[model samples]
Each structure stands twice: as C-alpha cells, then as structure tokens.
Target: MYPNDGFRELERAECLRLLAKVPVGRIVHTRQALPAVVPLNFRLDDDGSVVVRISARSELVRAIDGSVVAFEADEIDAGAQSGWSVVVTGAAAVVTDPAACERLARTGPQSWAPSPQEVFVRIRPELVTGRQLVGGRTLYGVDLPS
Candidate 1:
C-alpha cells in the first residue's frame, strides 16, 4: 500500500453524519441566470433531506423553489490543519403543505438574521459527497505492508 496521507474521501453515511452536526451551510442556486450563494442555518431530516427557513420576501424563496441546487457545509480547525467538507446536490422545493410547514417551523433551524423567516424550504439530496483531511495527510485506517 502507498504511504498513508491524512486526506480521505468520506462515505455517504459519514458525510450525512457530519452534516447533521453542522448548523450552517451555503446554498448555491441560480438567481436571474447567475449563480448565487447564500449562507443560512439548516437542519437535517431523518431521511437525509436538508431543511432551511427563509423569509417570505427573501429572493431565495423564488430562486430556490422547485429548482436544482447545491448545499455545502464544512468544519475546520486551522490550528490543527484538519477539516471536513460536505456537499449536497438536490432539488429544492417550497413547503406548501400547512401541516408539514408547521412541523418544520417547529423543528427546523432557527435563523440568526433579524428577518422573520416563515417559509420552509426542503432540499432532497440526490448526491452527497465529502472529504476530510487528518494530520495533513489523505489516509485513514488502511494497513500498509512494510
């Protein structure tokens, strides 16, 4: 086996686990035919879906509704030079069901922004990928022959 580097690709289960621990992520979507990235707080559903709250008047409401988008979250320790990043690509949909919206409102992420977020958007992930760096190398636990 090759020399063990700290860098390694994370499995889907691990990726989702990391996402569950993060409260904030960037949502990448198309706005007016241009790419736009917005930082927001999010929650992970049991089924691996991402949920976020937005203001009714916010541009993201219209831009992300019924659209395909990318969502990313990461955590890094600069001192240790180790970190992990997770990216999720999926279709976003505005929650129009009153009952479902109510449930989300009670369980979804609470936004730090002053605006009153009344709209709940759900992103059903189609693809999920992640990578992590450990001890400045790309290897995990594989045993190498001398």
Candidate 2:
C-alpha cells in the first residue's frame, strides 16, 4: 500500500536525477483566464533548470517569456509499483540573445515536436520541489511539506 505519511522529499541531486530520466513535462503558464499546461520535451541542466526548444512564433513561446511558469515531470512503473514526480516553478524567458541560445542549445533537449525549432525557452527554476514513493514515506520535497 502507498504510504499514508507522505512522499519522500528528494534532494537537489536526486531531483535532477529524476528529471534527467524523464523526457517530457507539463509546462504551466498563466494565459489570461487561468493556467495553460502544455507538454514539452525538455532537458535538465546542471544548474537545475529545464531547457526546451521551440519556434519563435509558437504560442507557448510567446506566453511564457518574462512570466513565471511551472514545469512538472513524472515517472511511473505499474508492474514494479514505483514512481516519482517533480515540479519546478520559475521565470521563463526567450533565449533570443545569440550567445544564450547557443549555450542553451548545447544542452540538447529534444525539440518541442515538428522540425526546425527556432526559439529556445529556458525555465530557470526559482522554487524546485519533488517527491518519490519509497518505503512508504510520502515526503513532499518542497520548501514546505504538503
């Protein structure tokens, strides 16, 4: 049975490890009325941020720049009864600065579908938190436990 206590609060290294294994995450941003969540293919950098490539004209690219957004990724093993999830809240911006974009591109996140992804959106996490279901301990990794 799943632990009643809470999920395990994963450390930074552990969180990065989980992010590395997960390729896709839901990117949530405020879109006038409410929140918009979009699935994006991303890569976790050593600095603990998610790097994603998108077209300059894409809706997500336009909506996210200079705004705070949330990115979440998770993994599950049905047969093994194990799973983990991570949420990163941060400011997002367009890597329009040539140098910045080049530096971010080097990390090599799978582009956000289709071909010729022209723009890069970098989410520098201000608050990162995660949890793992292990040994029946439910530890919310956020600064404050849930």
Candidate 3:
C-alpha cells in the first residue's frame, strides 16, 4: 500500500502515461531573471520528449532554449478534491535539423496562436516526478493531536 499522507508518489512510467493524456501544460522558465510560466499545447513524443510548437518570433525561444526548464501538467477534480500533478525538469532546445523539422512540421502540435511560421521546442526530460492527492477524506477524518 502507498503512504497515507494524502498523496502518492508516481513512478516514471505512470508520470509519462499521465502526461500523455493531458493536452495542455505549463512551461516554467526564467525571463528577465524571474520565473515565467506559459500555457502551451503540447504532445509527448515517442521518445517521451515534451514537444511544443510556438511562434517563431516568440521570445520564449531565446529565453528557454539551451536551458533547464520545468514542464508541468495536471488534472484536478474540484468536486472529488483529488488530483495529480506531474513535473518534468530538463534541457529545452529548439529543433534545428532540417529533416527533423520537416517531420515535426508534418506532425505538429499546432500553434494555438495564428502564426505564419512556427518552431518546435523539445524538452528532454532529465527528471520526472509526480504526486497524486488521494487523501482528502482521510486527512479530514483523522483526529488531530491538538
């Protein structure tokens, strides 16, 4: 059985599976020395890389490329008071290979914004971790040592 501390640690495989089911995720990166978060449409590639298609002019490309960034996606049930959150920390790189770019263009995540040109940013996950909140009831039901 897992721990009863209102959360369960998810394995790498489970985390990747959950990531695949979510369509939108937030990419956390540094901007002007401050944290910047952007909601993006993304897809998990066959190799488990987080791929996001963004406008070519987007400054995010310069801000995050060749840097360590955090990507997070989650599903929360307000009524059930339960949810799972997954975080992937890795290096973000702009795809520059002509062949790879062509393939990615064909199978795109499709930019949410209307852009004449777009590029793909691939985050090769170096660390994957997640937790599921599964004890909303248990925490409230337990008596406190007050």
Model 1: colliding residue pairs: 5-137, 5-138, 5-139, 6-137, 6-138, 6-139, 7-137, 7-138
Residue 118 miss distance in model 2 (angstroms):
1.3
**Candidate ranking (lDDT, best to worst):** 3, 1, 2
lDDT of 2 by residue, 1-146 (tens): 12233556677678878888878899988887687899888888778888888887787777899998989998866556568878888999877788777777676675646566577778997878777766433333324335
lDDT per residue, candidate 3, 33-146, as tens digits?
A: 998999898988878889999877889998999999999999988678787888888999999999988988888587767688788999998888787767354322333344
lDDT of 1 by residue, 1-146 (tens): 12343357788899999999988999999999998999999999878889998887877888999999999998988778788888889999988899988787778777777475478889997988787868555334545555
Query: Clashes in each model (backbone N, CA, C under 3 Å)?
Result: 8, 5, 0
Q: TM-score of the candidate numbered 3?
A: 0.86
Cα deviation of 112, candidate 1, in Å: 2.6
Point out where model 2 deviates above 4 Å. 1-5, 78-81, 112-117, 135-146
Candidate lDDT values, in order: 0.83, 0.77, 0.84
TM-score of each: 0.82, 0.79, 0.86
Residue pairs whose backbone atoms clash in candidate 2: 6-138, 6-139, 7-138, 7-139, 8-139
**Candidate 3, residue 3: how far the Cα is off, in Å:** 12
Backbone steric clashes in candidate 2, count: 5
Minimal lDDT window, size 10, model 3:
137-146
